[model samples]
Target: MAQAARRLGVQMACWKAWECDRAAPQSNRLAMMAGILAVSPSWLLSGIGAGPLELEANDRAALLQELQIASAEAVASQKRVQQIVALLGSVPVAGDSP
Candidate 1:
């Protein structure tokens, strides 16, 4: 966000204000911001032009499947890590009396 603010040549507070609708970007800044955000200037100004890409139904389904698989893998990995931690907790230290 800081980097983006720098690129837009505004302070972070100013950027945040625009984001929160507490302030609005000037005309020139609007174009720069649109470029930085990869949206059309018209869209940025009035929400009337090319905006973010919309995923097709098939693409959305594929992405959903991938995310689900990654989530399941993460759960499995977490369980394995917890098991390892429990095992380590029971192991005796090298210099400790058994």
Candidate 2:
């Protein structure tokens, strides 16, 4: 559970730490389970008592755009690292003459 939180970049404090402004520990536990399963927190807790929070069309679009940007950046970084590796390999060693 902690490893999953770390992979998602969520702090353990978000799940374990006591916060006066937030929900209680039980609520937090439910929320954590929902997060792990990628489902609605309320739905996970209440079993369809209240409807799920629907994402707005624009919000979904914005999220997709952000994901695309992140993917592009990751690919660019990988290419840059590969280029650096190739450049390093091309450098000749002084002790080993061709």
TM-score for all predictions?
0.51, 0.45
- lDDT per residue for candidate 2 within 14-84, as digits (tens), equals 64443333544466566766666567777665566554457899999999999999999999999999999
Query: Residue 12's C-alpha lDDT in candidate 2?
Result: 69
After superposition, candidate 2 runs with Cα above 4 Å error: 1-33, 39-53, 92-98
Root mean square deviation (Cα) for candidate 2: 9.9
Give the range where candidate 1 is weakest over 10 consecutive residues by summed lDDT. 44-53
> In candidate 1, how many Å is residue 85 off?
0.3
| Poorly placed runs, candidate 1 (over 4 Å) | 1-22, 25-51
Highest TM-score among the candidates is held by which one?
Answer: 1
> 13, model 2: CA deviation in Å?
33
Model 2, residue pairs in steric clash: none
How many backbone clashes can be found in candidate 1? 0
Flag clash pairs in model 1.
none
